[model samples]
Target chain A: MTLTLEKSPLTEAAYYILLSLYEPMHGYGIMQNVKVMSSGRVNLGPGTLYGAISSLLEKGWIISAGESDSRKKEYQITEFGKKAVDCEIHRLEELLANGKKITGAKQ
Target chain B: MKHSTWRWISDYEKEEKWLNEMAAKGMSLYGFFMGKYTFEETEPGKYIYQIELLENFPTSPESVAYLRFLEDTGVICVASVFRWVYLRKEAASGPFELYTDIDSKIKRLSTMKNLWFTFVWLEFIIAAANLAMVIYGWLVVGQMAWFNLGCVVFLVILGLILLNFGLKPARKIKSLKREQLICE
Candidate 1:
């Protein structure tokens, strides 16, 4: 099935997960990076992290980088994932722009 | 010291809640087999437990890979029996949840509901066969049919119980899916 980028906005959890994968990182490293990058606002629980990784992998947004000696597998985002992030950023900017116009707030 | 207890439970929500309550009281899951849960004493509320229901048993290669992924995320697998996998992580490490978004939660619930309904249909088929056999035997065996009737009755009852067990999760899945659609 063709996935439409317009149907659903990127969730904060998914966005951060994709963001953390700009470099190859293992599962635990992804969780830690998400927590730090979100300024402690978003914490990806193991279950949530697992589901996100599986979904992204299935969507061809991420690929396995390799496995460490510890048997922990690492993942890195694909070009598709980078495009998805850009689309989300554009959508968010539109929302911000519309909100500022309505509130007559200068930024 | 290793401690063990057995519980016959099919409902996932109840089992997850009960296991977490046990963890809060210092008995954390160590392993499980059949209906027996093994625990090693740990600090109260030191661990958080999460359960996932799979369509196939845990021995499958897909399931093994899935569990390995969770382990890589720092979650420990405590036990797996049939289609249910029990997992726990130190509470101090962070939240012990596996699903943080509604979409993933909905997908998982749907998978479990489908599994339950498959069992219900299988039970239904057995019940139908039992009734047919009892009726056929009654026509041919004359007065020796009471035993067959008793057997058929027992099968029917068991089937009904299984049907109820299946329907509960099916209902929960429907409601959750509806809620998810509404949110969308």
Candidate 2:
């Protein structure tokens, strides 16, 4: 299935997970990085991360990196993942723009 | 010192909570088989426990790979009974949670509900078969198999118990679905 933002919006947990994968990290690293990137606002649980990684990998948005001699498997975001991220960013920008326009809120 | 205890907890969520409570009191669970729990002495509040209903038998390769992934996240698989895996991580390691969002929670609960529902139906069918055979022996045939009536009674009771077990998770899934709508 095409994981396009227009088709189905990304959950906050999923969005942060893909964002954290640009650095090619393992499971625990991804969880920690997501937590830090979101300023501790988003804590990705182990089970949720496992499920998201499996889905993202199946969707061709991420690829498993070669084993780094450690038991932990690493993953890196692919071009498809970047494309998905871009699509989501545009959608989010549109949401912000429309909300601000109506609320007369300052950036 | 190792401590062993037996507690039959039907609901996974309540079992997880009870295990965590035991961990907070310095009893870290290290083994579990069926309803028996084995714990080892540890520092108070040193660990957090989580239980999951696996999609297949825990010994299956699929579940093994899944558990390996969880281990990489600092959660170790302590034990498994059938499809139920018992996991724990040190409480010193920030915070540990198996599910962070409602979607995954709902999915897990649905899995549990479906499993119980299957068992309930299986038991119910067996009870019906036994009853039919008993009637056939008494009327259609010439033998008196009144003793089989007792077996049918036992199976029916077991099936009813399982039906009750299935309903708890079904209710949980229903509320979770409502929460999903509100969140969206």
TM-score of each: 0.85, 0.92
Task: Point to the candidate with the largest DockQ.
Answer: 2
Clashes of each: 2, 0
Q: Over 4 Å off in model 2, which ranges? A: A1-6, A105-107, B142-144
lDDT tens readout by residue for model 1, A1-107: 23445446887778988999999989888888988887887777666677788888888888899986787898999888899999999899999999989888665
Worst 10 residues of 1 chain B by lDDT: B140-149
DockQ of each: 0.61, 0.76
> Ten-residue segment with the worst summed lDDT in candidate 2 chain A?
A1-10
Model 2 chain B scores worst on lDDT over the 10 consecutive residues at B142-151
B1-184 per-residue lDDT for model 1 (tens digits): 7799999986678999999999999999989988899998999999999888865688988788878888777677788877888888888877777876677777777777677667767766776776777777767764445665676677677767767777776787678777777663
Docking class of 2: medium
Show where candidate 1 strays beyond 4 Å: A1-8, A68-71, A103-107, B139-144, B182-184
Q: Residue-wise lDDT of candidate 2 within A18-107, one digit each (tens)? A: 898888889888888987888888888888888888888888888999665686899999898988888888889999999989888665
Chain B TM-score, candidates in order: 0.87, 0.91
